[model samples]
Target chain A: MTQGRMGASGAPVVSFENVRKVYGHVKAVDGLTMDLRPGETVAFLGPNGAGKSTSLDMLLDLRKPTSGTIRMFGSDPYHAIKAGRVGAMLQSGGLMPEVTVRELVALVTGFHPRPLPVEQTLKRAGIASFAGQRVDKLSGGQTQRVRFALAIVGECDLIVLDEPTAAMDVETRQAFWVNMKAEVAEGRTLLFATHYLEEADQAADRIIVINKGRLLADGTPSQIKARAGAKRISFRLDRIDEPFLLGLPALVNVEIRHDLVQIQSTDSDRTLYALLDAGYRPREIEVSGVGLEQAFIAITAEDDRDGNGTTPGRSDSAGVASYAQH
Target chain B: MNSTLALARAEVRRLGRNKRYSFFSVGLPVVLYLVIAPSARHYHVYGVAYPAYYMIAMASIGAFSGALTGNAQRISQERKDGWIRQLRLTALPANAYVIAKIIASMVITVPSTVLVLLLGRFYGGVHLELWKWFAIGGTIWIGALAFTALAVAIGYRFMPDTVQPIAMFVYFVMSILGGLWFALSGFLAKIGDVLPTYQVTRIGTDLISNQSVPATAYITILAWFAGFVVLAVIAVRATAETV
Candidate 1:
């Protein structure tokens, strides 16, 4: 929707060109390449140790990439940041102690060449209530908000956040996204790394999934679900033809036990219509949507299974089913 | 440049609010001078009256201790807490943090040096020419600046746990061996001759006694300052990725 309005013709806000970061024997980020456009809210989704943090670190120039380059607004990431064109809040980012929240925010705001008013930033971040409180004395959740307050202290085009709501309670998390939506509405690009699948699905316009330091999939929420065999269709049939069933339209995976058959499909309607066209009458037909959580688990589990071929008890579909139940 | 100075100003404000820092860096020196300089009125060392000599020693102690111990510990803790990492995300220049810290340390050291010098003038009764007062204060301030570089080196190189003991060890060794705690003689003075802390005190004493300050004193302090700056640069560079 944003791309339609802004027209994806401008220079990318961020671009990673085959970036690789290696530590001793481990390649933290290996040959990763992606681009984020203007006014886009991109969600970086990855399992633990999937090089998400490493990639973000390299993007912000906190850690040098062993090879490849990251460009922000056609210049290098560091220069773009120093030019006050980007703002970032790392999960490891901490606040200065012994100062009131307002003082800390104001201090950082003064660093930007074009700064937002400190009070406006505080209000926007939902931190105005505790502006007078000392930063070190805040609770874990309150501290997270203050760190977020710091990130938006400056007027920057791109805002990068790493697990921005990790410590927030449910209500605070809701309020956070509300404030965040207002920020993004102002034509700024946002990139956030998150473990919360539903949060990503709800907030992001585009989602990039990575596993084992490699891009597994990159698409919108529905596209990612579709890639993971989005819908499950099951029925009991009097006559079962396993070979023909495998050839069904949009079929991703098929399993048959005696007269009962189960199929995973990207387009359940097309698969169902195709089955009827093939003269198969199935009873007790049940179709269900696999949510983004299951899709995410399936994607990463498939990658893990592919990477480690020997250890095999469960498959991707089964993992999806288990997570779907949860 | 304005942003860096703004950060430095904020740091100075925070330092003012810290009671423990104020007591140790400024108050303790005044109390120590009031207690020690009175008893040593009849004595003399380094070709100047005892109060005059002890005045320099106490001022050096207050300034150097504040520069070394307080800053080292705070920097290490801040680094560990990812405050340095947080600052890097801002538009501020890369070297701004260390520069602001050094600036804050320098600004905070002034009042301590001045207060001790005033006590030496009125309470301790060690009067001096106007230029001499400025010279002595400037010398101690510059010496603390050197120690601030050393603090940055230690802070960037080690964790807070290790910084505490290391800074303490350096503080005590430099203070006693440099004759800041008391006047050294013979072999002790010979060893103290090589130390920047001792050289700083000697420059102040030499200025008061109407003798030309030794070239060795200036060379020793400047050399240490250069070495500490180099060490601090290497430490900051080495930890760039981690921070």
Candidate 2:
């Protein structure tokens, strides 16, 4: 998921080496290893039970991983944070109802050696207008933005976020990404976990997928998609026999209902041409690259796939080795 | 601005602005002290001055009020919301957070103690000299730090919803047994002496009565303050580590 520090080569700013965290008997994070580099923005993606939040907690050192090491700026994340190196925003927005945004930022900056100008930090967070508004009066998205502002309100080097935009509308989410891109452009590092595949695709140079407490995939967005393989191909044909289409090479699985035709194919192009050969004039043709959503579903939907769908290699040490060997 | 003073200013603003926090910290203490002081005027346990008795009880009420409210719930909410973690992102040090909490505790405690004393003096038949004010203020300041440590320990160790009940219980028990009249029973004095409230009361009443404080109570109060400071130091470390 994350890379180790690259040394004079510019090592990662955040690294998780075979980290494990358990709540009761439930393994919230299992053998998860990941890295994030300075000026690099990485997206962590997974299903409902995929341990994204737990991994964040471990990375932030709010909850120590039951096993393994997590480092930020090449030190224990919590220790580094105490040393004024890391900033974070959890899923639930953090703002004291009693304090205004300016007050909050001012209060938190008190925890640092060289805090940013309060007004500037508020402007960066887009809550400058609400600087005097108590937190309880702010809307959810505003509160989230305020929380985001507070995180970077410190001049900390690393930013860790869990579901940074879950409450925002599409417009605000985009605005947030644009702001994040600007921050990353400033040579800061970011690690955020989210369920929105589009978010990962847009915000992260690298995407990591976790399923059932373990890492299922980690790479550049295309790399993860490449590993997930070409999973979906949909089209509208003049007319194509379902059985005939299913019989085509790499089209062994096909579903046709009404005017919509869907197929899971290893070689989508091969299947597309065959439909053309069969005198099929389509009203619409669509082919999806193994995007993060496809990658996420493919990586997590294996249990019900029988023997048909692709599954990443199950490596107990596979995830661990990724970090150890690095 | 000085960090502690800034923290205290913000804390006072919080208590004033939020009607709920204000009511709990400001209004409740005044109302309760008013009601409590008037009711206690007629009662005395073992010849204790009812006025001084009420003052001591009300002071602990102030202590619990100040200690329990923002110190824990606010911190917990901030912790839960990722605010503290966000603070870590800033150049802010962890000590500021502890300082802020202590300031908030004092801000809450000061007004609460003042109002309770006013109620005791005006209506509760309590006569207090300037020195008595100084002694009470000094002891209460020490008690504020002690209570803050307890509040933080609870806040860090328990969920917000869960912590309120425990704090309320401590407030109730400390006010009742450790005090004389608002106390559930005067008979509980033997058991009350072990509580910080009782030691604090012993210290306060001694000062108010213009008599020498028992060396034991001063030692106990000092021990109480030291115990809390030690615990708060540990809790602040945990907050930095865990939050």
Candidate 3:
């Protein structure tokens, strides 16, 4: 809320302006520029080696950008972190092993000027039962929960989780998100980097896909799906004319095998109507949007094809639509 | 409580929980004293009885070894586990982390120093005045600062697996070279006189014998302490940047 007040003049809660991080010959993060406004639950979706973690490190102030700047709450990342405005759970690694979970959490709580009660933090992180256990003795999932508790104890305005649930079981992951949703309700800006597309599709209001240290796609889930430009309409047709099918409205590509014809269309509704109007009796027709996983692959693959080293996804409508025909 | 003090307290609690630290910081020195002091009790070196001299020697060695290795191992382990990055993400200042380590090392060093002193007084028949006891204990504790810095520098410079062995090797070499094992008399004594470890014991000997400690001893020890501190700062900065 204080961060929101500070952003009254319309500054983003977090911004990266052409930030680049170079490690010798490797450009870990290449000219990354993006912003998260207050209360936006943005997911950083990328494959491994996609610069997601590198970008997160710069945002967390653990690593400095080689060029440009990263601002959190209108100040540098370190200052924001120092002011207790940001909290993070990194992908791997852990707390001090010798101390009990509660003590480690309490120690982190002391680092902040205003922190949530340790009990409440432990409860929210779902580690209250094991709070007395030494950190080194915890299972991988339990250690992650302890780290999550440490992150929330500060009650920071911006919570950055790099694969927060990477080690959790199915049930634990579900419960973690349930608690995460409650935290999000507090209107804090949340940014999480994860390889799990389902997590991004379900948890993020806006998803930014990065690949090879470049932004591949940035939009809402539906927008990204639409940008991917392919919807599937499958049906069993006794007889089909391939040319006629390809000629149908909004049809991009058509595939036929045995009695099954799979239509890849930019607008499945229009394609379906065209199929019906053309007197083709297609039985058991099913329509579905291109899933996030497919979209993610397609987007990154597009970047791979362009290979011209030019920034491709900067323009949302034209850039994505241009690739629709291909 | 301040963040630094809170972190330091946690470090102390960690040291308390660590069985290996307890063994090294308290048990090993006392064991070594018990094993070696009796046979050397009657042998005199440099106008002091060997038991009394060896008592201070074992105390210094144990305290220094514990402080250096303990701090370095903990820091290297933290770095390996990404705890240092976690700390960097918090509001805790970088220097506070270093300072907390120094404090924790000192806290852990105390038990060994005291235990060895008491062992000297009772079993080794070390009959120093009260002021001399205080002075010896105080000198050993202060001398640990150099090792603390050395350990911190090593922690930042090396990986976790190598940190301990490197610290132990440094400690062993310094202890031998500085005459903590036995009193050196010629060129070896000259080399020992220049090292901080030798100066630490020399100052303790001066306290017990009621002799004024030469200014060179203070200068050498302080110089090593300063050099270690600078190395620690540079090493920490280098690791932070590369990380």
Candidate 4:
């Protein structure tokens, strides 16, 4: 299964150079630029309508970019895909119906220049038990697994998936990542687009965040968290000095409702100390670390505010909550 | 090319499993021929024996129904289900899906055409030279191929729900007016003169009667085929981004 999985050069496995896809008046992907290295598990993080699907579509050569270019394996995406170097399972990707799972696997596997044994792929996708079942008759999760099986049916060096676990339950989602990890361990580069923040945080070595059809942030989990603000501090003060509180050290954002002030800071201890050193006693002080979910919210919400100038400070939580639903 | 052929092979196998396809393309025709051809022995159509003419009619009915309905509905449903998109992700070439579908349609037309002619031979007692049989079958087979192109156009250009009625409408109009169900005369004959289905039957009956087929018959079939191919190309290209 991992025959050609060795000793790739330093060249990036995939790269998008200012790629854009315009649909009439809407810019689906606007000047998006990024690159993926070999053996890297990168998460494409975005909200609904954040151009994640469009970008992945362009990368897979399913949809052409209106401007600029995308390259895979240092070649055009279409040629690289035709060479059977990249395997993909998109949310829109569907199975051939009216056939047994095993037959569908075998048929697709035969399309590859270097194909794997069909039984091994069926087993790896955890679909061996239902291999005899018709594809259209399976449950949603089983159908998803079959789609995943098709992606790994060949000796691919890169795998791209869009919301692969969207239909899976928690237990199935965990099992899926375990199976996915085994595939990536063969030194294959994996790029998956997902809105599930924890999945992105847990599975990806690097996370590339996009918002409104552009790159918002690209870094490791910790760096993204830090860049958004590592700590959140909320306190109540008897004498509310909003301006003075906003001026606190290491403050990233400040939200005030009467005497209750919520603060997001890079260093919570420093901000709190500065508040006390300013001769103000704040009551009910609470300081906590920010999870990747909150950090993602902060990053995207900030972008939304900057981009549209309509969703104000309160949108940080509201916008993210709505985005998480999709 | 190999991948496309593999896809076409799988398509053929799936079509074999479909009871609806089998009934429309072979079973229905064989049953219809058994029931209708015996009683029509005294009648004649377009200078050919009634049994032989009905053979062409039944064969044309089966081939047209199978080629148009089975393929159009499947293509539209597959597009809606994202099967076409999934195939696009494979290492197969871009046009492989459409080509494979056309190939499968052509392959499937064979059994139906041959079955109807065989019924005409042993059961209907319509005798003809072996080459005439081949010519008739081959002509009907090519007509089915032409309809397959129109099916592709309909499938690519519309969703499954819309394709259902459109394919049915086309099937009824072509089969009835083109004299697949009955021989045309007077005004209906004038109207049926231009249809590819009527022309296909004309070609078959002309071959059976040992008459020179009209140039207009060939021109009508070719024009429809060329027009349908262009329509299929345009539909496929229009949906390129979405597919």
Interface RMSD to the true structure, each candidate: 0.7, 3.7, 1.2, 0.7
Return the lDDT, model 3, position A265: 75
lDDT against the true structure, per candidate, is: 0.89, 0.70, 0.83, 0.89
For residues B1-243, write the lDDT of model 2, one tens digit per residue: 365566567766776676766676567666766666666667764345676677666666666666765576766666666555554444444466567677767766777778777777777777778877878767866766777877777776666787778777866676677673354344577787777777777777778766787788777767877886777667667655466
The stretch of ten residues in a row with the least summed lDDT in candidate 1 chain B is: B19-28
- List fnat, each candidate: 0.86, 0.57, 0.75, 0.75
DockQ of predicted candidate 4: 0.83
Q: Deviation in angstroms for B134 in model 3?
A: 3.0
Poorly placed runs, candidate 1 (over 4 Å): A4-7, A234-263, A270-285, A309-326
lDDT per residue (tens digit) for residues B49-143 in model 1: 99999999999999999999999999998999999999999999999999999999999999999999999999888878999999999989999
Question: What are the per-residue Cα lDDT tens digits for candidate 3 across B93-183?
Answer: 8668889989888887888899899999999988878978888898898889789998889998999889878988888789998898888
Enumerate the candidates' DockQ scores in order.
0.77, 0.44, 0.73, 0.83
* Stretches > 4 Å off in candidate 4: A1-9, A235-238, A256-261, A280-285, A309-326
Query: Which one wins by TM-score: 2 or 3?
Result: 3
Candidate 2, after superposition: displacement of residue A125 in Å?
2.7
Q: What C-alpha lDDT, on a 0 to 100 scale, does residue A281 get in candidate 1? A: 86
lDDT per residue (tens digit) for residues A1-326 in model 1: 36622257688889988788899999788777788988999899999999999999988989999999899999998999999988899889888899999999999999998899999999999999999999999998999999998889878899999999999999999999999988888999999999899999999988888777767777778778877799999999987878889889998888899888888898999999999998878999999997899889878887787767674323443343334323
CA lDDT, candidate 4, residue B218: 88
